[model samples]
Target chain A: MSINKIQEITSKNNARLTWEGCSILLDINDGERMVFERLTAGATLKVGNKKCSLQPLINCPFGSLFQVENGTDGPFLSRIFSTSEGSNDLQEEKESPTVYGSKDNRELMDNNTAQSLTGEDIDELRRKGASGVEIIEALITNSATFEKKTSFSQEKYRLKKQKKYSPRVLLRRPTARSICEAYFKKRPEQIGFLRMDALALLLSMASVTSHSDVLVVDMVGGLLTGAVAERLGGNGYVCNTYRGITPYPIDIVRMFNFGTEICERIVNSSLTELCATSNVTSVSSSQLEEACGTRSQSNEEGPSSSVPSLDMGEIMISSEDGDTDISPASLAVKPCKATKVGQKAPLDAIKSWRENGFSSLIIAAPQIDAWSMVKELLPLLSFSAPFAVYHQYQQPLALCMHNLQVGKMAIGLQISEPWLREYQVLPSRTHPHMQMSTSGGYILSGTRIFGSK
Target chain B: MLSMELENKVSFKRCIREGDLVIVYERHDNMKAVKVCENGVLQNRFGVFKHSDWIGKPFGSKVFSNKGGFIYLLAPTAELWTLVLSHRTQILYVADISFVIMYLEIIPGCLVLESGTGSGSLTTSLARAVAPTGHVYTFDFHDQRASSAREDFEKTGLSSLVTVGVRDIQGEGFPDEFIGQADSVFLDLPQPWLAIPSAGKMLKEDGVLCSFSPCIEQVQRSCETLKSCFTDIRTFEILLRSYEVRGERLESWENHAGGSLGSRKRRQRSTDGSNGVEASVSATIVARPSSEGRGHTGYLTFARLRCVI
Candidate 1:
């Protein structure tokens, strides 16, 4: 209803206007266009021929309210300070007699004399210890009066104490951190080993997630994968892979037994592969050792390591070329009963870390096919162990071994998304290998490269 | 001082002293007396309490009057001043001000450019938001209005944030240095379409721009200029409705009646009941009735400069 009244007033004339709680009634010529706008609260209204403006001692809406007034005094202009009729009446009743008839009325009128004051006038008044009310009164008194009924109309009402308004800083609700914490609490068991990139993705998802739904992340960045594993309750596995030949197999066996059960199994298998591949003219044990040293050094200094770690078991696995005569099955050295070795392997080790009553599968692989094989073997070995996959150069992918289906779903969804199109390192000249179809599965048409360059 | 209980059922805690007068609460139904002893008592039906009671209380506190009515004792915050100040025109609301602040990135040490100081609501907000630093230069063609705005600034202790001038922004652009020095520019006058070129001259390379208009046609024209002058131009409206949040019954009166209905048929019946119409009537009428039903205040268009080049 107030909005309608405001609209009516604004539309009637092109005068700029404002509204407080009440409508301002301004005396303007009919159909005359005047600009209306807001001043700071407690702003005075300049009226008539006076140099000073009339300061309404009440809060009014910001905008101009217009109306036509006819008088012998050349159509004098007056703006309504407020329009709350009841309050106006009450104020009028209290101040009318005193303002009009009191001996101090002369001083009030003197104060009300409309005069134009510059910034210096205002400063001088302040220097003289004048209050805002006093300064406003002085300005009003000094200003011109274009209307003949100024005395009666102005004297008819008393100036009510103006209520002061100020700006406010709105308090915003808590951010995504609280919500993410709540989500993690609601399903503690669903969380697995998280990597840095995975954690970042989770944070992003938390930013947009509603109260419903569990978060699933498919980690595809190496050390970043380890970082995430640490943040999500550290109850998963770390998987690593190595490749080489001969005495390198011996070093791989030493590294496999160096950790837990899963770690030992992984190291033993890699050593066997190295031994079998040592006979190959193209590879040597010394080269294998050099590759291992290089991978370790790279992991220590990179953005890939920024992932928060989740406390979990680790299964270190490595592979290497073995002597051509050594059967791949013999190359499978299960360091413990908990470790599982597959048949079609050049040579690999499977070590399981089953301490603290939680099994974690850490798989380090040089090839996508090897990683896939480890993933397939995950459910059979330990359904609850969280699995971490580490790959150099390529995006490391991992899933909670216990929640195999969810892990698969997360990978499927990510592969279908267009996030890869924005990758900076990808050669732009070549057409993208993955395309998002209308139905949402990625239409893959190019050769799939796995493992580090 | 009479010992009589006031007819409005307001009880006096003490007598008024010299230079002190009792003030009644507007919404209180009962009469109560407050002692004006240099420290006056704000009395009503709620309870008789000393002004000292609210001295340290934060703004937005609900103090009880002598007659048991609740009186919201708002602190002398900038927003409260805007709520109570006299305006010669329509004023900007907190919703609009919030967006303007965010879009403009209004902060200390920035020069703000505004046109047509109407009620000075935005001006007050800008003043306070950028206070202790920053400056606001507002222009209006009417000398009387500008003077009035100047008075308001004096009262709110925010005259420093603003510089009121009597000039038409459309006639001549702000001075060269003033133009390029401004961090943000807000246009709240009619024919804001005419002020865009001035905005271009005045705004910095990545300065923010905003235009508040009451109609879509005005918005369309403003947008055209904004597209050429700035980049990342976006327009949005903010609607704020306060809800009575008391315990589990947090609800808004506007949405209470028809908000929970899940079925289309039931919703139709409810709508029909309110409008006295049959279900067979067009759904368009039920969904959106007429212009009268719309909250036709104005449209706000915002833009940001990507590069001067």
Candidate 2:
């Protein structure tokens, strides 16, 4: 009970501090490895070969940086103050004009004998209580080519050595931006290769805002559901509708630091349930009853087996994402106090949706046919309500747009693929990133119209 | 233009009443905002459209002009408004605006600040993100621009969620009253570096800031200034590539090749008769990016306030 209360107090959408039992994103060594964890007394993070308890991270601000240090017990994480920020070296160098030395890399050899220090000597220094920074300094001092290298190569050498010896873990808030980027970079398949820009465009095109009734078909592992819920901010209802009896899993919504208020707003309902009151003639009553029966049976088994134990202390760091994995499942089980987010939508809410229709609709179900899904779901939106549908392939959306145009069911129809290019802005060295995602995906956006019916 | 209440939302029961703002959409690229009045009428290329004909009609209804030409009257949304708003200055489009909102992490309860509220394009979306419980404070140097933005907010029914002030944010910085209270800040000025320090002061720990510049040099200077009190500085350029779709009928090479002219004529005649003949016709849907699009908008540089106690 005490842990639950602590989580509630610190789980605000904009909370700055990391509380016990709270979810966090650990960025190790400038995104060399990213991990999501729940702060508990027994939780641990693996940096290099050593594992350290995360108890020291509780009650700290989100942007604090921690460096691994050798303590009496073993390797532990210690907070590095602002005075020793590693980025300061780069910042200071940029202040002065960078003048290339007369020396060139033509004389540099590819042989592996650049340093005189042996592995045994480094281990001896570690055993004698030398910190990671001190070890890096010692390695730099012993390198035979340290003085002969240009300033640029010298900085690169130091950066590479620092990553190996002293990796820093930056505490970051698990917002939609950071979470989407992590999933896209590490595991694009889980989220359907839905890039961050595409997700943002979908939310904007759908006009998701506070107090608006938004209908969504999120097949991309609940990333769409969670992004919509974050924008709803606990005011509007984000009703995730699906086909058949069983609802899709929304495991990613748990990554957001949403309090119970927002969690309650995220509900799910089957298409039959939503359309039952709308007098949809496609589904017969006998079939609807069978669907309901299956739903009730699944409901009985849902909480017992599907709901992972929210015990914070039992959480573990996922090692599969060796370099960048904000393991979604680990954070999904973090919010022990949250009333399950994807509960069955209440009957009264469904009744209102059938009567008034949803204010907006956003569909990201890549597995289903876009035109057929829109045909059944567009009528569920209020007249003049906007909608955005996302798909990895452009053909389905093109066909969907053409069909909608021919049917006169929507206006302002446009299929747009968002292109994002990131730039590395620096003094006299600003240019776009050499590599970027070619396609975030295509989105077909339009406003639903009032049919003659 | 927004649903301040449940009843205000577009629905079967909600219809166009007097004193409402509606977007008269003639085509995908043609739209204009008009306020509904009892005696108002709009004259355009389509024809003369009487406001009386639109009254009591549900939004998204296709209303006819006196000449039998018609146009759709849709309830205004932030995205639609961006396309139709008069450009008092170079405005932010959907691609840049959407990315900024997501990166800033704006929610319903977050307080946001912006400078040089040009045409109130992004401000409209910002107000939408921080509605029901939050607010957006926008400042511009030009008094007329600021007042025009105020009028636009009022017309859009977002006055309660936004405030437009006439202040030079670059020269004067944000007001002291907002010191350490803002959840996010945005800058779109010629010299954003001058306002970077004030944006840092106005943010809570871990709050985010964004600066939009049209040139790489400006981005270089802004990033340099941001390094003093911000972390995780990143710059991105987001553009939308719109695709046009159409169904094209192509003559199948295998069907048309090595066939006499009479056979080709016979095939054309039977194209609509059977599924096999239709398959030979190859009526396929194709999509391609539009020939011309916005090549560049600006560089968006985002940073987070350093969490130092």
Candidate 3:
């Protein structure tokens, strides 16, 4: 009951909203329309045959629709962001007039009856004042395949036309979902092989609630950290153990518009600092951990513009305990401080870290030894706390699962790859889509069994 | 520090104090949710285990039974709770549940409507997904099942954010009071097509709707209905497989003799228990797919409600 009460009090601020400075994820109407792309305000974009104006006002709020000159016939706006409680004056965008009704059973004409329309005519018509849907109607009437195609192909043809003709552009505040869509579909290499579907499973398997205290060693450019923070909704904490001068994932995290309170909950500490903070430390253990947090800072990427540099006060607490004495020898080899990035992590988070002992732990760093990371972090989890480690290649997680099995530290070890196939649900001809992504990374989820073995 | 452990706040601490729903993990399949009482006993195959003894032990701490057998007293989380809860009907596992939660775009403070509450497994996750600020209005046709789910909601401490309505969603659409209120609507019924109209009506402008069906025929019918009322329609099926791996440490006496580790001991024989032995060139871990792999729960069809001015 208290969890419910706590949730009600906190959920108010998490709703999506739009403003002048908001970083919005726009579902672009291009051939690659399936992929959502990030766009900031005050930047003009070339939409399909049209110039999309994106002038932002000072703290201006965005709404679902806006009326433009001769805009009544265009395709409806799918969505835009606004505050939860307010009623905006903007008019709602209407659905496309050429509705593909499920009951449409019109007989098709023979193939020889009509020839495909010329590209020149379509270009001329588009230059004229015809809407995308209008041009699509012309395409259907002129195309030779129109008469011979099945209902599914007909629908597909219409969609192709919609994408080609419609110059629709939208601006909405970036949520974890949008940020995930932008990265996973657009820049898969940048975020590793982690897909949005896979990320969802990882979060759910870990039971990441609004009140969860989580531990993450995410190498997917801070996606996991931002996602956990979003679910936390400003409650609890996220300990992100890093291996560099600055945390890698902060760039994507800042786009979600998580408030200062939520940002504070995302505690950043070097992997070295984290391993050093552990109550039980050995020379070998510390030496192996050095490979974790002490990355020669890569200043090559330059500073990410959207993310605010973290304050140093949060990072320096680790040294105060002096529990694991900072080795003078290792510090002497400190990588040159080129354009000093983010903040230095303090050890203070360890005090709280020792108390809660993290309800869930996630390792998505494919570059690091996931088994070693799991071994070091197992003792830091609450009893029965679920942890999910992700790797594009199955061998690493397989080894981790084996080590966990041998060490008796984990149970219910599952390696899951979500099989996704989109459906082509057209009238009278529904089937699986022809093309789909085969893999979306692999996940090994299990519980930390801290019981006596 | 003291304030963090408020009576109202539920957290995984070391002890099973009063009001904690401890998950008695017997195995992956055999598990139970036991309410910790001052004088209570959990009688399982392990033996008679008193709740009094478990009251002060840390969660995941192993307590011996009167007959010398033992089991783990683990903390109850949403994911674990899903696996252990008594099944009243087929439920959504973590795989599909995660997919639905993400694609449906449900987040904190979003109002969601769920029909045919069945086992409340997905509902439990849904409740957690929209916690503290969001609420899940769940409806089930069966009177007994609906009331039972409501009771379960109270026991699981989700009553505050979820409401169990005992109306037939397909027969009589979601109560008119919620006609244009829900941020998202979910249908898990035999004829979700009949409920699609109601779902669309209840959804706010540009709100999303998801229907879970096991068969493709049901998916086809649902998509047909959805095309008339929604946009951006998609269908997905999620599969989860587990891998159980075992490690064996091998020592050699003849071929490719392995060197001895740091002068801890002098041994002529091979033992399988020693770990991280430098003398051994590699740690051979044998991994195989686990016997229990849940296949094809259902196809999740998600669509965004078309903005109808």
Candidate 4:
């Protein structure tokens, strides 16, 4: 907004302001030290072929723009004011304005007057020490004014109008608070009161406090069962079985490959159970297979699949193996997959759960068959504590009743103590597969492997 | 409806009406007890006295609890509202607020405009920063949300610094007068690009602007609009993970072993294992009690205003 400097005001009343092809007429008393103030409003005035508006005419002892227009015979002065309004006004008046010549002088200057200067011409004058008002007068006097064109055109005016409300800053990413709030509002009852563990885990993930590495483990029911325990220990770890589907570590790597099928697969599988349930009918086996295949491919090809794997047999082996110093290479193994109904997949799922660092599990299925299957798989995995299970159907479901470390724990079945009542073996009609023992614990009726026997 | 000067005092009174759920620290018996009522006496095993005696007194003044105990009635600050507000959702924390304010380079006496007034936590901070001469106009599409935010603002006495309105910024552009009048604009809503054109219409030339998004895809969309409307667009993520500092066992736990802090420790250990060694040496086993750590939140993006032409 600061234009070029005014060299000198030779005569106050008849001073000629010149720069580039523009000039201004300052009508002031000769020999009088006059303070020319910058025009705040209505500074754009026309006197003849030449037009002028207020400019921040620097180096003139004061910051003022005296608009002057050139006529056929002489220079004509426009609206004038004394300086002293404020520095901010001098800044505001810099906005581009239209300059016109007075109507009376229009016909007389048709042959003598010069064409009015454009904004570009004024900019050049401004760069060359001519004040905005001075530049306007110079352009008018030098060029013939057959109908001087104003500095402001309809297009320029429209552009200025369009530019009024542009934001200075654009928020590039959504805040964690905003996303969490949206999620919570939509599914409050389902999520319940966010447990301190969950809040702490979220806070850690939010990275609001300090920096630390986190190892999240996924369990059976997709619940973050160990998040609280991990949070309580002041270690950063979150356990949610649901996160296993779209491995966060993998997602972090391929985040930039846009339009690729990998990205599409990630987006399609990003939702939680609600989305899963809604789209369940639409999900074909081929899609599920493809998802599983992609996970396998990533595990084989990506560097992030270094997460440890747990084996059931290694856990059930004698105490000697527990004491043995296992090498890191011996411990490494392929990631586990869910067992198909008929296929005899390795009992590695439970092993993987243990290796991943989860101490508990929650089961949502109501079938006793599933519970038996889980019981059959536990001994095959290496874990210190009895994996806790919560039955979703029961009001205030029983959790963490058995003390596996202290008692005669069953490896496979061994008709050992059953934690839940009404326990029965699946594919059986003859007798209760499980019966109550005199000590309040129930015993299994079927034969199962006993790792410790 | 009160002016900003009077709003703070009234907000304190409203906090009292709201059960003074936010605790004020007062010393009594070398311990602190909550001041429950403005008029009723605070009685404890130590002594009892009325809170009205401290009404006109300046904040941070000492008052007597009924139990003959002395308590400090520290005035409620913005931090208190952040902790005590009945959050219908996760509220923006101090960390994000600090970063957003600093990165945006918000100045005093500048007009700031924001949309999607979520919980008003950030709004309160913005209002406080640009007080006296500055103004903040916040918009939210949901009436209920706006009302809740208004209540909080009124209680906090920051309502005067801000103007709260319930309207969809995407559907209706900013008012004509406000166009090119704002010094800055912040969009915290989903699909913020929908309002970019509107933002362009309201900001002064070369003003500052910023946005908050969670996913990279969202960032990509926002960046496209930002590059078109403004210059100097940039994006980044802030990660905060805490360490466990307890007595001589000052070390981070192994649970948070995947973050930047973990890498730093690993680098240190690789250089000097003797310095890193402590109680346990098992490679995979977490040797020490892991200190709690913070992890992922979201991404942040920033941009600066430029001449459209």
Candidate 5:
């Protein structure tokens, strides 16, 4: 975890240090597909013959294309641009024939043996200060098949060559969406299958303002937790609860590198702790009064503590010790050598939780039944507080919607998935991208309300 | 009304204070922003509400009027403000506002320039996004609209972070001082192409720009202008559909307690894809999509300003 923190320090929105260990989105096959790749110095980072590395960077290497440091002798290095907009539009580069036809033009095609440039020859060309465009130009000039191709085919051929020859890597800044995208691409299982689009919908439906006090149970580790915390702008608490001996997924949380205050907003409690302490809805008014009575007494004894809510720091620590993954450095647990903190933490959490009831409940628990999970949390929110639940399949979310209807617990329950389509709008060829991923999980949204309470 | 941020922070000052922007919630759909004053009185359908009575009450507290009617005085956030603010022109809703804020990457400490701050709905979100640090310079061609938006900003306590300017951005352009200074720019005018070059000039290298237009032709023309100075240009439309969900008493409903005609109509409505789970139990769930919903707002065309290498 500490090693990851150091990596994060060097890898943050920093444009100057996009060297080894930098995360990037590799545009492969002329932007047909995107592969999320992390850069490693002196290592072969190939996106179709475009090998890259970090070596002897005396100057900033942004706004430049990738190339070999010493051609065949050494590693890759980014060279300065000869001119701004180094690779001009392919169409304007050279005047070509008419557009390509659907069928292969066998009659017009020329069959001939061309001068084939070997690997060493290409390396020598690169070593002799030949640009990617110049090398492609030389190859096209020496090709016997170049004359028979149509204009459209020529553009396609040039783009293909550019992808293979052009050594360019985009150093993208890490945003919440980008990190989420990388997670979806690389480590999707850790995120409860909640895609970025569905998560977007859930956040909006929950009305997650910066001022909101949110109760979150992120089965997807801290992906949802981090997102909600970021949205809150460190203004409110993200009271996080998980079942069993679940370890907080700090790896994903470290990507954002939020400070101690933001991390402090993320208070944790086990289900054993929560279910044992309080179920305010099931309790009668007299019991509520008794609980309030004790809460006042506790507040008097622990001034500035607000009863158990503000006193569970010790409880959360011992409860977290069940997992070996908890970093000792991150948790400064005051040497309280007792396991009794778990029981008090939840009581304190609920006591503090009911004080300024949560404005929203955001859940991404595909592992649990959505209705049961939502039903248990609904009573904790203020009347008319909104909630959005995420499920990979619609069945569970739909069940929760039904339960909301039966109990009259919420209104305006909507289930939706954002329909996103990427379009390629070139001057000549304009249409939607050929390949697209449709499902971004399912989101069920509603507002909590009471009837004559 | 007090800003949600302020209300969330200053717990000691809980009551409705003078000059506070308060969201007076009369119903789910009917809500309005009322400026709280020491002795001001507001006459509504419920009764004449005295600001004096509401002065010492906490936010989210219910207060009574002279006629024994009551209303909720809640803190105002962008979402609530958007719903309650009077519309001078076609305004973006919460869905599109959230999408733009996220996609444009409007973090705190970023400089954003927007054109024709119509109704200031999106502008408010942008201000909130870049709050306590970043500043938003908004330009509107219409003088009255610009002044009105400026007044609204002042009333909402966002004047410090937002500066409203009266300028024809499409015809003239954004002020010269902001050229190459803004981190991102937004266009909500009819002919955004006329302003794209100016928007490009206002943006820093690799900065993002978004143009909201209802028609596809506008998006096409704006894309043409955007191509010269932009990369990765894309368009999107965001829609939010809400459902009304409620629990039903299965046994009580089956007994025809509401009479034949009413129950029959309810059953007809329920059978129309309401209850997917067919279970003979004590209670069942029912959800119907809201009949009143926004259909189409505008297409948000976002593009990144190409590096000026």
Candidate 6:
């Protein structure tokens, strides 16, 4: 009956529009800052020094844009409708490239007097009810070097001022790619430096599909678990197995707007329980209950929650003190206690896994040695099932690959490193980003073969 | 390649059955898709192998040829199918394919659109991502290529999830019936800018679109067109560098000098007994990037449809 209820909810929730309790990724000032928050009535998002309620964003669709405006009450986020003028400007610029000035910046000076507007003057303008755009215009009119700059630099100057005066927030859905990117950008260590490209490779290498049972060792928080669960879409089980009775903390799963159906499919079981001989089911069930008890106790302690060390108050305070460049921080403000995920795998599910074996396996335990762990876990997968192991360092995966080859337990073994480089594709200036991630770690992928035994 | 039905799933009891499409793997790079019939026999570099020997065996079984050479019979997965599919056009490899799927935010029950069905390499993986509940409508200009892709999807058991049409999307855009119904659209065409307007019309609010091109000029033009109705446009080039691993034993030169890392004591004993080899030899697993690999694929530019409502 609960499964049917969740199925009904899944069909209703297409995940296109934000709801009262849905999670959202807030991209502030075009990725100058990124924050994660729930869309409850009381949830507040701080843009610069102004803390505004997120109520206006509740019913809006993902990819909607909101601008921070100084309302009668205070500063608030207002929805920004798309305008055709932006595209017209771009089109005109493309058509008339020669209209850009040939002037150089040789006469430009680095002196602070380029802008006559002071902090107090800007505050005074704000008090006078001058909009952000009006203040920008006033500043430009008063600037001594406004006419001396090249057209390109003028556009750059305007963009810089826009970011500081009128901040914009773009609502983004927290999919696996966006979630991995957020963590990878802000806190790489939390997710074991698993870049989005590397994460995608893991999913593909393991062949995660609907209706396929997936076994995972998600030590890099809950990123791998949530990703597999998203691909499964509530059809099959994503069983997270651990070395001991305690399972890894998968708080990242909460960031996804997975309905009750998808959440129910994400379960956990210890390695011993999954590999326990058939006769030992009764003893393992008792152990499973014991593990469940400890898990709930840990959850109460709150150590197994969202990304550790995300201090929302500190980021807001730092930005409010006129620190323009604020390092992005993941803020989990009262994550609505939605349906529970990562529950202990039921006895039936465990028994079924033991009999049928998992369709595929993905291991992202950066702390564990790949060879030792894979040696213990590979047999739980059905013959011909693919597996991918993630590690920040290549030596571990290399040794794992060597051992697998020597033992003849797997075939098609290869260790791969993902190279991801972003480009700035502009009209006349298209090049790779000035800085890029040197490495996205390594993965050892192979397919399990039936041992002669 | 996918288990659509529970009974068809790979399990301890699920054996190689008739009419099964299996990937015959000789090496990591050497693989072929084979349709198993009762009287089917396969001839390869190793030797002649009879299909009857593999009928009752489970997938991943190592079946020996008549001349004693052996190879593996693996249950087909989308990844392996990509490697074995016929190259009707320049196909997308795993790196670009994986990145595109993730960046597009595709999941189950999502309607996806693609163009140029180039060899159906990416389409196979796309079908896997949106299987059992979703559908993929892919169009190509070449009728022969479209038909071949359809047959390939049929062989891989993905026909129910994908529909291949013979239409030049760059010239005629997508079918009008899919207006505002697609969760994501992917364009891998020479002139993707020609299809940008239709793609914008077909996407639901906030739906994502990705364009793959090998040249920066195309990307430049597409971004100009996308600025009208898309937001958060970003471009990335993704590649995979494979490494070869080997267990190598290195001999220490200091062992010849009779002192290093406490090996002197062991060397003294071994020189009087054996050849003093055991003390200096150390076996360790080492890995390095393969000397040659794909240097360039295409740049993936992803953008989200701006929500106007």
Question: i-RMS values of the candidates, in order?
Answer: 26.5, 6.2, 5.5, 27.0, 7.5, 6.5
Tens digit of per-residue lDDT, candidate 3, span B125-210: 88888875778999999999998888888888888778988989989989877777777898999999999998888876667899
What DockQ does candidate 6 have relative to the true complex?
A: 0.44
**Residue pairs with backbone atoms closer than 3 Å in model 6 (clashes):** none
User: Which DockQ values do the candidates obtain, in the order shown?
Assistant: 0.01, 0.46, 0.29, 0.02, 0.21, 0.44
Off by over 4 Å in 3: A1-17, A30-41, A48-50, A55-162, A170-173, A275-350, A451-453, B1-13, B247-284
- Per residue, candidate 5 scores C-alpha lDDT tens digits across B155-239 of 7778877888899999999988787677789999999999999999987666789999998788878877887778657777776
Clashes of each: 166, 0, 16, 77, 13, 0
What are the runs in model 6 whose C-alpha is more than 4 Å off?
A1-14, A83-103, A278-309, A313-334, B254-281
Evaluate all candidate structures by whole-model CA lDDT and list the values in order.
Answer: 0.36, 0.81, 0.64, 0.37, 0.61, 0.81
Give the alpha carbon lDDT tens digit for every residue of B1-309 in model 1. Answer: 111111111111122233322322232122222323536665444567667654443222345665666554321223334546676888876446644654565543456888878878888767654433457888888899999999877755467558898888767655555745566799887888788888877775656788888766677677667655564344545432211100112235674676445543333321112332332243222111122322434556766554423
lDDT of 2 by residue, B203-306 (tens): 98889999999998899999889988998888999999998776565566785668556553332221122342343335576777889999999999999898
- Point out the higher-scoring one by lDDT: 3 or 6: 6
Q: What lDDT tens digits, residue by residue, belong to model 6 across residues A278-395? A: 3334556677566556644544443244444344543332433121323334433344464588877777787788778899999998788998889988988889999999999999
lDDT of 4: 0.37
Better of 1 and 2 by TM-score: 2
User: What tens digits encode model 6's per-residue C-alpha lDDT throughout B196-277?
Assistant: 9999999989999999999989999998899888877888999899997764455567646655566533212221114323
User: Of the pair 1 and 4, which is ahead by TM-score?
Assistant: 4
Q: Residue A405 in model 2: shift from native, Å?
A: 1.1
